[model samples]
Target: MTEGKRAIIQQLLQEYDIQDAQDIQDALKDLLGGTIKEMMESEMDQHLGYEKSERTESEDADRNYRNGYKSKRVNSSYGSMDIDVPQDRHSSFEPKVVKKRQKDISDIDQKIISMYAKGMTTKQISETIDDIYGFEASEGFISDVTDKILPQIEEWQERPLSAVYPIVFIDAIHFSVRDDGVIRKLAAYVVLGINSDGRKEVLSLVIGENESSKYWLSVLNSLKNRGVQDILILCSDGLSGIKEAIQTAFPKTEQQRCIVHMVRNTLKYVANKDMKAFAKDLKTIYTASDEKTALSQLDRVTDKWDGQYPYAMKRWHENWDAISPIFKFSKDVRTAFYTTNAIESLNSTLRRLNRQRSVFPSSQALLKALYLATFEATKKWTSPIRNWGKVRGELSIMYPDRMPD
Candidate 1:
């Protein structure tokens, strides 16, 4: 039977020059219906040397059927291929869920990583594997394997960036971290970039305890270290001390306060009785057609609330210098800088990942999960951002030294 199979393979080579395992598998798949009878007849009762079973040709077909075989299929990194898994076993042959531990299951890894990113618990992942892929996965092995994505995360974090970013949206996401061996809400400063091609790429991620200027400076410094020479507009919440930090670190950068955040912050001080009236006025201040209209609305909002809530007006005044500039740019620019919405979406994705985690054992573990989540999330960044061409052209004119060659 073995000799005959070899003869068939030799004949196939002579006739078609097909030799690779993937080609063989593809051939086998095509040859399955046509060759099944011939293979059954030739190797009917041949001993396959599998544990605990021996039978003749008819017997093997009836009782000791073949389930599947492992072979290497050359892909980007030679992915493991389950070439023509035969379901010959009648009972008790529950094929292992992960298919013989073939390394670099890119397809499976993507599936598992996506599920893991969406808040699936390890147990849930195991169940999902069983249900979807027909594999039994140990919880610990799954965790260990998923956590292995950190090196990739490190590589991604340290990757080089384009020379110029016209507009950058920066925000911090707080998460529990292992600090001096204790878990706490350490802030992670994240940046989103609108590059010359209009692609919105994530520029950087940093971990810190608080979103202070000193910490943000360190984050910005890391970005500079990675190759970002200049930025035209930087949008963020009113993180005190960040303005001077941006000017000092990214000397040529312009800072814009997130108008959405400013309004929300001011609303906190508005009395409940006047909240509705204040919101109506708030819309006028931020939603106006032009900078002049916006400024006029702001004066009215302040005048109405200032005498009663002096601190609210004072806070708005303090942030006015930062928020006002956004109104001067094009409508597209205004929409983009109105808030830190870019990072906000990323934060939502991270939140979903954490919700599944519940309580993380350590920060490294958290980082591992987040890294995988981000990797999967990036797959959905399939196209460049809107008005990116216009924004990029604007950036080139604004910061000529920063545009990439």
Candidate 2:
């Protein structure tokens, strides 16, 4: 170390009588508190245009002057310490280092927010802060810290989206929230998209009373209002009226029904003994090389199983329009759009995070938790989806007018 720095350290050691690690910590805490106090005093002097105890004509003319100090207990990473905050006669001298009514000078707020995003309960966060920082952080304090993100969430919800999304996945995840002293179930609709540059992004997250096509229509309309001019393909499950909703919002967009969900729904009707054989036949239809071949396979499967399981084959016919769109894309594009797996994977992360809280206190609380979880889950989506180069080429050829250059 430099001689001047070494001399200052030696002076501090003698002044605080440092003997061990705990003593060093205490000395550092005192030093930090004193530093903040000095900074506030300097701020007051700067505001008043003169140093402390210095009498001048300009200072005498001005009415604002130091009015003693207020003892304020502030929390920091080192620990908690009481600092004297400088006050002004006119109450206009606001200390920029520690603003008025601000008690935290540490990064504990950000630490709490990061923990909350990882699905830690407020109480858990309180205990963690106490354990790590040697302070008693109330649950209310933790909630107050996390509540600061509400405005950010609002801005994110209303942010504009790209004019065209080559592939978008829409899905709903349900949670229990308390309303009017009673617990109610609500759905948080998640929309994920692959933009024209072939990178994945979360388009929007909306919390609704329930999963309904009526609500989904509004969600799609919100997307349109946010600058989504066209969507080449939308992948989702067979929620009733969703097809009609998509038609109303973006009629030109091709809707691709999740083939995985369709298979699961179809298997619900097949007998246990015939499930293996039935699923084998059903796979041939969806996995066919082309639309014509898929139809032939569907006809063969229908003739063999229709009499025994009529409803299973009937659903295929009913939703064939939505399911048939996948056959038009190349393998790379088909793999990306054939199912709602992209959004479903995101949903799985949300579900895991939600499991920590059995029931949220309010709809806002539910939204806050989901929004934080979504941010955490999507942190690593910096790159394009697998084989996005080939997928982009295929989409460009398929939607020549919609795809960007």
- On lDDT, the candidate that comes out on top is 2
Off by over 4 Å in 1: 1-111, 130-136, 176-183, 287-294, 389-405
TM-score of 1: 0.68
Worst 10 residues of 1 by lDDT: 72-81
lDDT of 2 by residue, 16-89 (tens): 98889999999999999989899988888899889998965663555777789899998898878899888888
In the range 320-402, model 1's lDDT, one tens digit per residue, is 77777766557775676678876666778888765666566566666666666666677787787666666566656656667
Instruction: State the lDDT at 4 in candidate 1.
Output: 94
What lDDT does each candidate get? 0.68, 0.87
Global lDDT for candidate 2?
0.87
Error of 2 at 358 (Å): 1.4
Q: Going through the candidates in order, what is the number of backbone clashes in each?
A: 9, 0
Candidate 1 global CA lDDT score: 0.68
